[model samples]
Structure formats: structure tokens, C-alpha cells
Target: MLGIDCPKPKGRWPTAPFDPRFPKQNQTRNCYQNLLDYRPCVKRMRRRGKSTQPCEYYFRVFHALCPMSWVQRWTEIKDGTFAGKI
Candidate 1:
């Protein structure tokens, strides 16, 4: 379930949780954790003038970090809600 070969779903994936301890770094860290490295995507989103909601960035980060298979399985897990995932 933690590997890179999981099957991702077709629809949009859910968002990852935010880290409370590091509020300032939460967006960057969470996005990195989810998308592996979303600096470019974040920049693109910013260029596109998208709303800078944490959840939106988090979802993009998730798409970047997770494999296609894992994205599919994520819907089944239902464990990574706003409350917590790890």
C-alpha cells in the first residue's frame, strides 16, 4: 500500500492533511510530502491565478507525490482526512 506500483483512480483524488506543528511550513512540507516535489506546479498554479487555498495546493501535492495506483487505492483507505493520515 505504501509502494509506488499501486493503481490510482480515474476521478479526482482527495486532499492530504495539514501539519499543525509547523504552520508556516505546513503548505510547503505537506505539498512536498504528497506530490514529492511540487514547487513547479505550485508556481504554475500561482501563475494561473488560482485561489491559494491550502487544500487546493495539498491536492496538487498529493497528485504529484502519489503514484497512479496509490491514488486509486487512496479512495479506499479513507484514513487521510483533515484530522490526520500518517
Candidate 2:
């Protein structure tokens, strides 16, 4: 299941250089697009008996690549806690 609250950026966050070979290259797009890319892996995981765990892992990946604010909104929507416009 998704978490209710957004992830808070911790101290001493180091900026990493961008790499084109990263699997989640288009993660900077809107939530809808992000969901599109994530859904396939999620389905495959479920078919392999992973259940919702894979979805949670996707959320973690999104949180890691996206800004804290974006992660908060995404988490809210994923957890059914967001009811406003995106």
C-alpha cells in the first residue's frame, strides 16, 4: 500500500549527475505518464506473485527521482488522500 504522507528530503542531499541509460528516463513527465510507464512493471510483478509490493516499489522509484513536492502529490493520489486538481 502507498504511504499517506509525502517523503521529506533529508539533510545533506547530494546532487547526482543525470545519466541517459537510466531505466526510468521519462519519470519527469506528469503523473499520468509516470503511471503509464509504471503500470507494466506492476502488472508483471503481480503475475509473478508479487502483488501490490511492486506498486510500492514503483512509488519509491518515483519518490527518489522526482522532487519532494511531486512525490508528496503523487503519494497523496496513490494513497487516495488527494482530492484536488493535479
Candidate 3:
């Protein structure tokens, strides 16, 4: 997955999530590829005030870079957690 710069969809978030069973259709989604990409996006989005970006990207996969669980764990915290309070 290195050297890949996929394009993210623009405009309002999609009303539904891309089906994971058929990932190629959602392969363009370049989100949650790594902890580096996932944690920081979540961190900045959480810090952003009065915005829908967080909710949108939290569960939204971009170019299939990140996993759904990684995005869904936005609110997950505490010891031994994946990535939190960063």
C-alpha cells in the first residue's frame, strides 16, 4: 500500500457506508491505512469545533486505507487502547 495517493470523495458524506464484503469497489478510500493516518485524523477532527467532519470520517473509509474498526473506535479510550487522547 506504499506510494499510493488515492483521491478522496468530496462534498457531503455519503448516506451509506461502502460494503466491506466487496472491498475493491471501495478501494479508492484511503483512510485508516495505519495508526499514523487514523489517530491523527481522529485527533484533529475531535478537536475541530462545530463541524461534521469527525462524524463523517470516523466511520467513513477513504480509498480503503483504513479499517472500519479503526475508524469506529473514535470514542474508545483507556489503557491498552488502540489509539486515544492523542
Candidate 4:
């Protein structure tokens, strides 16, 4: 038998963690909040001349929950059009 080393799997699938604020089964608001939070985090970090790495958490959460089309459309609009305070 040919000997080969297989790499062990790393972490679990990229999904949002349970947020105490949104304990209910519905995650619609959770997804929306993440999207809103992500933008402001990026803006704030950039304004402070800091890395945007921390904002990735919000980005990951929203992407996991929100539909692609909605994310795309929301992102495409300028800041003025976005209802959220980004």
C-alpha cells in the first residue's frame, strides 16, 4: 500500500455564533444587524488607521445568513441610500 499523509480537517463550517440578543429561532434581524455592524466597523477602523481584520466577524456572520442578492444590492448602493448608519 502506498503511504501518504492526509491533512486533518481544521475548524467547522463558517457560521454565525449564537448571539444572546437574538436568542429566538429567527435570525433575520441577526443577519441585518451584522451587515450594519460590519460597515461601521470597517469605516471606524479605517478612520483610525487600523487593520480591518476585526470586522471580518460581522462580515462572516451576515454572509452566512443573508442571501447573496440582498448583500450585493445593499453593498452596491452609496452611503446616502443605505438606511443603516455605515
Which model scores highest in TM-score?
4
TM-score of 4: 0.80
Tens digit per residue, CA lDDT, model 4, 30-65: 999998888778778878999877887787788788
Residue runs of model 3 more than 4 Å from their true location after superposition:
1-36, 62-80, 83-86
**Cα displacement (Å) at residue 21, model 3:** 20
Candidate 1 Cα deviation (angstroms), residue 80:
9.6
Clashing pairs in 4: none
List ranges where model 1 is wrong by over 4 Å: 1-53, 78-86
lDDT of 4: 0.74
**TM-score of each candidate?**
0.31, 0.35, 0.28, 0.80
Residue 16, candidate 3: Cα error in Å is 11
lDDT of 1 by residue, 1-86 (tens): 32223233457755555566447733544544554333334445567888434434555546654565855555444433422323
lDDT tens per residue, model 3, 1-86: 21212235676655435556446755433353433454456546556754435444443444234555743453354434544233
Candidate 4: stretches off by over 4 Å: 1-13
Candidates in order have lDDT scores of 0.47, 0.50, 0.44, 0.74
Model 4, residue 27: what's the lDDT?
94
TM-score of structure candidate 1: 0.31
Model 1 residue 77 CA deviation (Å) reads 2.4
Poorest stretch of ten by lDDT in candidate 2: 1-10
